[model samples]
Target: MPSPFRHTTPPEPASAAGPVRAVYTQLARDFGITRAPTFVVLSSVPEIMASAWALMRESLIAGDGGRTGKELAALGVSEANRCPFCVDAHKMLLHATGDHALAERVARGEQPADEDQARVLAWGRATRIPGAPELTPYPFPAAHAPAYIGTALAFHFINRVVSALLTERLLPGNVQRFRAVRSLGGRSLSRTVRRHPAPGAGLTLLDGAGLALLDHAGPGPDWARATTVGPAYAALRAAAGEGERLLDADDRILVRETLGAWDGAHPPLAWDGLPGRDRPGARLALLAALAPYRITEEDVAAWRTPDRTDAALVRLVAYGAFAAVDRIESALPVRTAKEAS
Candidate 1:
């Protein structure tokens, strides 16, 4: 099937070269799929690709909570974000974990029959809102905290990327829904998903600030730390670049101002009151920041021109995702050691 991405194309599973090559190879060897559509779009920037893949692998796939719990968390986030791509992917992953009945119920928008599964799903949905609940007496056990939070955050970043860059179509048509097709899809990931490095494994590459961010919220679980660093650094790095390629001087100021004054709520943009509403990149940035789930093709159509390359869109989206992630992270109730224990 032809790709829905207009800016970037998926690299050949065998054909990817450079920094992404090693990561792609590891994904193929470990997970069965060589190039995930999400990672493929992220490959527009090799650094983003490598960093995102490592963080996601450590937190979601390989972290403390079981795959079933993590997929539930991911599903909650994607559902809140209204991202069909990730919703379908996680449903497939749940089935891959050998819970076809539960997967079907979730795919059909039913709650899981299990109580613990229901709690996890509830927490994930709550996490999408700014300051919705406290982490104290978290629904799951302390050990599972990192895995759950990390999974939510990772998809918080990923759902945005998918919504902005990729199309919603999982397969050419409804073929993605066929039992045989999704099951075969599940088989491919069954092997590699369980092979991730132990959660909280130290990252050798992080600098002082990066390390501090991981450590800032106290001696949290390893998976949580890994999850925080991945999105935080990736967002900061994207900000360091020439995002101006999309938003001009005034548009940049508008984005920063809007985000700075944000109250951690997804408010509707009074398009008439917003700055840079006329510029597609700026409009996309605001939608990503305030109401990412609300972003539509019209938003993209407004900003994209012959000159706006896929690379630019990727960076712009990354910036908005990080902006929102940063806000959510700051408002997240910091867990104390006593509370964590």
Candidate 2:
């Protein structure tokens, strides 16, 4: 099969070494898929790839929460981000949870008949709105907040990278649109979806990478403290922050100020304050942060000189995506210890 990757050489499982190989091995074992386009697109940068996998593994696959609820949250977040690939993947995972009827409802864009589940899905979608009331009094239990919120956040980053870097086709010919294919894909992953590996397993994959960033993550959000989520989130934050180096000091400030004030609404094409193609780096970074789906071939060609490797391009996009991550992180509800507990 042709690689889904466009801008870089895909990592080889057979020859991958150290952390890269370890992540691939664990992803296969824990995620139950041989070719995850989502993770492999990131394999060009080992730390970023591992950090992303760790965040997803610890929070969504291994963290505390019902798989059904987490999967719904993931699906909702994907929808909010306009990531068709992740949306399909999560809907299929919902099928793997043996709730095919509800998966069908979500695939059809219908609200779940169960009101609580509907609210859960709504809460997930509302996440992109930043500071929206739907985020507070979280639809799920407080104790499960880390898993639910972490899962939402993990996808918030993943969806951006996926949307910007890869095509929307989850499968060749985009056959995932067919119900039978989605169910089959879901069935293949059922066992893994059914099993929640112990938390902190993904932390090992970070090894050298996450330790330095531990202090940077601070105590984590009030909702996710005392859990494995903090380290993974920090590790990813640091990894993606490397991309900031791609932009100049002035451009960096511009991107940050723009994203910081964003109200979580998607902007229209040709909106003001966006850098022109003349400043391809700033333009690409902002688009990746705000509306990655709008990135066009010319936008990339303008930035990709023969001297620039795929790794550099990936980091640039990660910088933009992480800016959005930072913006959303600030607006997230902050509860005190007593309230969190």
Candidate 3:
């Protein structure tokens, strides 16, 4: 099959080695998909790919939160970000959860009939807002907050990555658009969705191996402290930090300041304060952080050159997305249960 990647060459899953291979292996065994484009796009940075997979696998796939609820949260985030690809993928995953009615309802842009799911969906979407009051009383159980919170945060990053790096179609020929295809695709992975993966199974790809080499990998945010989510979060943070080298120090500061002042509302069509063509990388970064869907072909074209490779674009966008994630994480209330001792 042709790779879903547009701007860069995706790693050959067949010949991938070490941590990259481990991530592919786990995705097949645990995520039930052999070639996940969202992840393969990061294979240029094996540690980042492994770290990102760990966060998603631990929280969305194996963590303690309800699977259907996590899917709702993920879908909510995708909706908020306007990532059509992720939105489609999540609706299919929702079908995998066997809530076809709910999936169809959400796909139709309708609120779920169930009050709890409605709240969960709302909470997931609302997470994009920094310090929004709705965030205070989390919709899921406090004890299960790590999984729920991790799932939301993970998608916050993943959605940005997808919108900026990948094309809009989740599958070839846009096959996922058909209701039957969506259900069938979801059904294909129902076993993986229902099976309980060993908690922290993704760590096998990150730990003790040279994969954990990021210097700034800290214990993660207070909201995600005391769980497997922390290390995974930290590794991703450190990995994304690699983008700092792509832009001038001043451009990085500009992107951070822009994201810090953001209100989670989409910017006006004009998107003021963005740099001009002279600073295409920064422009792309800021867009990735706050309004990835707004990014255009010209925008990417402006930054990409013979000198800048696909891996660099991925890093630059990851940096921008994580800047926004940092802002979101900073404002996140401690709604989850206190860290385990």
Candidate 4:
């Protein structure tokens, strides 16, 4: 099965040097996968990769809520984002958590039998809707909120990346559909996906240089604050690129201005209303922001007659995802502000 990764190929773990090699080894060992595809693709920018892994580890992978609840939240986010790839992946993980019936219910688009589980899923979906005020009265206790929030935020970024960069099927062929195969795959990963204490701040990768980015998110679950940084870094790094940007100066200005006025909700902008240039690249950026899942080969055809390069397309997608994330994060009331004072 040939990989669908075209814009940027996952780097060989053995060939990776220094920090990149360490990140690959740690993620592989801890994640219980031969290769963590998302990490590998993000490794195109090493700093982004390391910080993303750390935030995910601190929040979702190593947190308090059981695997069932966490995976449920992940599935909800994936479903809302319309990313079939992540939806399938989380369903497999949910099955691995020994809730076969529950997993099937979610995959079937039905509510879980467990009320708490159902609430978690509902919250996840709610977060995907931008500018959704009154996100208050969380379904879980204060202590458990971080894990769920972290998991949702992590997958929010992930779903966008996977939709843009990778193929839908978890495996190359139809193997992902076989219950036995998904179950076995989940069991294999069970050992490696243990929880860890939330590592609060002071990560060397983020140092003083990038610390300010965390402020935009305005505090909450420890995991949310940290996870917000990953997308921020991605957006900034892509913006800083010296190459020919897909969104030129005027297009960039339009996106920023339009996004500034956005109501912070999904299905917000109409297709034609989205800011775009006459060129294919700018039009693609508008499509990415308004309806990423709708992007198809025809949309890609508009930009590149031959084939899409990894750098610009990936960066543009990241920027669009972050723009949405930032809008939501900014709209929500600050959880950590009162505590800080």
Candidate 5:
């Protein structure tokens, strides 16, 4: 007998043209299905994202060098979030970017080959297991430290935003969208936020970046907050870009002091005498306190561990904390005349 999954008649196109119609058209074209695509109708958010994809593309490019870093970051975050859709999407993106080996490893939940890839993968794993705060550090040779730290920090922010987007179900073409295109580096979570309606309508709440979004539901609040962390993130990025030359005796002191504070606040959630809702805030405060020392990639590189699992998780948290600090620092105004100009 013929297979039960044999080709079936296609669905009729919608009489009225809309976002769904457009998606249907695109899906049909992509999948080579003459019939309409089976995806559920999406809201205006996806359409908005499609229209403003360029801006989002620019944001990701500006944040990282290109799709490779962005994809690595996305994969790390997806792994952290435990979102199957995101994992699939990021894996596809990685493959498309000629990172076939890394893509295969990520699919198997195995560690990446290089420190940068490994660090990102670790970040993703850590995001899943929140109880093990000690798992945030990376395990790599000292020479690879700065790159690992910078990449880890970048991936942390990427993971936060992507997780929020996935949580909100704002991804284009629904959950399977990432499978078709692979690379989300061309997209921005900011655009996703601007395009979609806030989950709770007008409820304002704190996000990872310490900013508030009007619609504070799902991942919206988190991404909204992350947007506000731009300044601190930029500062860290600047320092990382400058490489080892940026470090000094004062920088070392700052790093040590900040690391000490982080050690004290390592498991901010585990601290006794804290309210339930206040845990995340407390963690954020602890992270903010470490901002001063996280000025360079070298500072971040110093946070690695030897054990694979523990190293991965620790690196993830460290990355998030570092990104938060970078965004905060970047927002500050430059007092010097040259900077102001």
Candidate 6:
């Protein structure tokens, strides 16, 4: 049967020599690197890889929890892409995030050092395979499946973006390596060859554990420090309590303003900050409060330009804050005994 993936045959070395040599020549001409080889024979994965870096950096600015989430997702994608460069980069990022053991496992492609890492890696691998079902046998809770699917889709989107850039040889450093990997000549295989009994069952359990970690860690210090804006959170809570939907422009403006203030004052939050922070609970609270507003790539892009200020940063903060709100509401049971009482 024909493959569903966009498989590109590796050009013959002689055929590749022209383009490979041309890329080096262009790099030399463009960058004026006369002495060293203009194009290092790295794989054609850098543009997407660079984008991943930018995305992660932006996510970090958005909030600590957001950074952690994006790091895991990036690791999953790197592993799926089978790009050693990305794998190495994510390992460093994970290490920086304080997950050394799991980072090592992901780098080596061995069984994850722990269940959390395994779930992420498995999810990443699954995203790379065509026609894989959204639901897996992994131990993830049924209720959390949508979130897992969201994670998977996020990775898928990143993978597609990276693959497009790499396949097109847009990244000079990766051109040679991409050509080499393609030339090594493996079948364009997908991971869905056989169904493992109880495959993905581990994910349900893993996701639960991840959620537990998030809960325990709270929004984390980064958010806690920024969201010292107590009045804003109070207003947000009151609005939410009154069922004043976020669609109202006034509500959005309030959320946007509060978050903007938070972002401006606080340092960019990172994954590593979570375990060492004093008030994970407060941080989590702030994040939980902010998770609900709809965010898009455009919103993220707005924060990326070099000239952004504290107020702009606050927009990102607001995005994270609302996101936190969404997460809290989604994860916790709504009809509690207190409410019923």
Each prediction's whole-model lDDT (CA): 0.66, 0.85, 0.85, 0.62, 0.35, 0.33
Candidate 3's displacement at residue 151, Å, is 0.5
Could you give the C-alpha RMSD of every candidate to the true structure, in order shown? 4.7, 1.9, 1.9, 4.7, 17.5, 19.7
Tens digits of lDDT, candidate 4, 106-215: 76779998898888788777776654542555666555565566667667777777776777777878587777777777777666654343443313334333433344
lDDT of 1 at 261: 72
TM-score of every model? Answer: 0.80, 0.95, 0.94, 0.78, 0.33, 0.30
Candidates 1 and 6: which is better by TM-score?
1
lDDT by residue (tens digit), candidate 3, 238-259: 8887887999989988988888
Worst 10 residues of 4 by lDDT: 235-244
- Ranking of all candidate structures by their TM-score, best first: 2, 3, 1, 4, 5, 6
Give the count of colliding residue pairs in each prediction.
3, 0, 0, 6, 19, 37
Q: How well does candidate 1 match the true structure in TM-score terms?
A: 0.80
List, residue by residue over 1-341, the lDDT tens digit for candidate 2: 76676556766667777777778888889999855888888888888888889889988998887999999999988999999989989988998998999998999989999998999998889889888988877788788888887898899999999999888888999898899998988888899889878898778877664334455545455567778887888888898999988888988889988987899999987589888888889998998888988888898888888777888888898888888887887788857322766
Against the hidden true structure, what lDDT does model 2 obtain? 0.85
Better of 4 and 6 by TM-score: 4
What CA RMSD would candidate 1 show? 4.7
lDDT tens digits, residue span 139-258, model 5: 333322222233434444433323322232334434434433443432322232122222211111112212222122222112223332233233333322222222344443444354
The runs of at least 3 residues in candidate 6 whose Cα sits more than 4 Å from the true structure, single-residue gaps closed, are 1-70, 130-134, 137-151, 163-341
